[model samples]
Target: MHQTETSDDQNSRQAAKPPLRIIISRGSDASSFTVRPLMAALAAGTCMLVIGGYLAAAGYMMLREDNSDTSRLTQAAQTRFYEERIAKLRARVDEVTSRSLVAEQRYEKQIAALKKRQGEINARHSRVADVLARAAESGLTIAASDPLPVAKPRPALAFDATLAESTEATGGAMVPIDASVDMLGLRGSMGGVAKKADRRTPASPEKATISSEPTGASAGLRADSVIMSRIDSALDVMNRQSETALDLIAVAAERRIARIERVTSSLGLNLNVDGDGVGGPFVPLTSVSFDARLARAEKAVAKLSSLRDGVKSLPFGSPLEGAHDYSSTYGPRLDPFLRSPAMHTGLDFRAPIGTPVHATAAGTVVSAGRKGGYGLMVEIDHGDGVSTRFGHLSRIVATVGDRVDIGEVVGLVGNTGRSTGAHLHYETRLPSGTVDPELFLNAGEKLSGIL
Candidate 1:
């Protein structure tokens, strides 16, 4: 019984073990199968993941490329915009530079003009200085009076430069300006300067102290400066007037000298050295009155010299010695030959025949010929309607249209037709009629007596 039971138990255990083993084996095969499919699926899934990852990466790359393209387009647009802006900026810079250069040139020009004006001012100042010095040298004083009856302040004048500068900006237009200098003050200063230059002093009985005025330096300096300027101006005027007078005199002298030269050339007279100098042998009769007038004019020259010691006097001394001399008289008396009362138009002097008869005064010889009663007669036409006739001459020394001097010989005394003796018949006629010959003779004697 124990053996049967153990055999049955063993058989049963063995049988159960087979079945269990089979079940286990079947489970293992199933598990294996399931595991195989799962593994394949996992492998495929891995491949899919890799492929998807790659595709995602490629999509991202494409998006990134699109973004990069967009960025490149935007950058290009910005670059182009910046380039255009830079070009515009460059053009603007060029314009600005050009304008700046032009402005610099204008500034330089203005500076040069200012410098030139300053130089002119300096020159004027120098001239004033010289004028003042001369005024001080003379013991003369200038007088000043009250201000002119004009307005206290003169009307203001706009600055020309300012108006021009405002309107010169690429346009032709008139511009109004408000900038103006104190014209009245400037005028006062100028007047003062003139007064000072003229050596004029304040005519006011009381002198104004420097502190009396607000602008001491300017006022005082201007006052003196005006005097100086006035002095200079007056001197200039006087000098010009004197120069004009001198010029006129010189012209007259030249004409007289030319006339004299012509007369001397025409006459067969010997002209050489004389007492004064070698300028001429005799003085022209026409120049005698001129010389007397010149003597008076010389007094004016002396006055000019006293004013300023710069002017020189003209040459006046002449070479002629004889200015007036009478050799005969005029009256009716007993003729030396006829012993009868006859009408004698002139007087006569005991002069040798062929002796020279000089001119008593400056005159022009109008006629030199034979008369009805007298021998050779010479008539002289003195200025101021006065005429003189010389008759009873042996030979006529001067011809018509001849100019003779005071000492020059015009004819020789002689006893010819209608003349009882050898003498010179001299007669003087006035504009109204014939005057007394003794009057002229006495006048000549007076001049001689004074000498």
Candidate 2:
């Protein structure tokens, strides 16, 4: 067994140990070298491949992670910014809406006030129309020629007046009158605006120009001032018109007073003054004046009275109307008993024997007795030397010294004085002598005395 194993083992071992190092030697100045280029090249190439693979993997991983994080951060920032913007927008929108609502409310209030003013203006127009209608009926014409331009309307205004009313008493009743006035003005600027707009020209793009006016704010301000001024002028004119109307009313009242005074005078309800150029039918001629010499005394008596207030001290109404028929006249005439010319000096009225005899003025009775020719005669003495004589009376109702007013019953007509027929004989006399009586017997005027 030892002999067979020794050759195989010795050959295998020799083959495995065959490779060895080679060296080259030269002269003493030469060098010895060993070379393995292929082995060195393979080792270097292997190391470079390993490093390149590692670097490519690391760069790919870093790029992918960075892209993902950048996308997430961008999305978060966009959401936050959008939320803040939305909140700001909502606040601005709410503020604008509130302002709009307030402006609308103010506009509505102004419109309502304007409407109320218009209604008042319409009412005033109606009143003026009524006044004009009345004036037309009374043959009057109203002419308003001057036309002032309208500016703007003014706020409402008011005033007061005074008037008089007639009551049951003779005096007039004065009363306070309340009135109101409205004002407005005329203007022409708004009407001119239409003309200005019509004259505007079209814009041109080639022109390098900016519009001088930015907005209508200035125009609106100008219009307001003009309107206010116009309104003020109109108010002044309206005030003047009101004053003039009041003056006209005063003049009309004066005319009415004059007419009333004339009526009272015709009715003989006034007192009289003699020789002072003032008298009423209530005063007898003898009492009023005596040859026009006692004017000062008459004036002094008139000063003591207030006849201007329409008060009278005597009843001066007419006793008879046109029914009175004169059977005889005043002044000298033929006496019926004597059948020849004689002084009659009296007026006569023919009537039945029982016909009433009326007193002509306010007076006191002085006598009721038979006279020379006037049987059953009555004499009355009015104040201031004025006396009345009644003859041809059958019976007397008033006693001596009894006061009687005009139109009062004095006696009954009869044929008692030198009788020719049933009649009444009335006469007036002064302290000096007899005077004509028929002048004061007018039915339209007051009688001078009572008989």
TM values, all candidates? 0.29, 0.34
Candidate 2 regions exceeding 4 Å error are 1-322, 443-451
| Stretches of candidate 1 exceeding 4 Å from the true structure | 1-329, 335-340, 448-451
What is the per-residue lDDT of model 1 for residues 136-188, given as tens digits with 9 covering 90 to 100?
A: 23211112343323322322322123222111111001112232333212111
Which candidate leads in lDDT?
Answer: 2
Model 2, clash count? 10
Per-residue lDDT of candidate 2, residues 244-275 (tens digit): 33233323322333343444455433343221
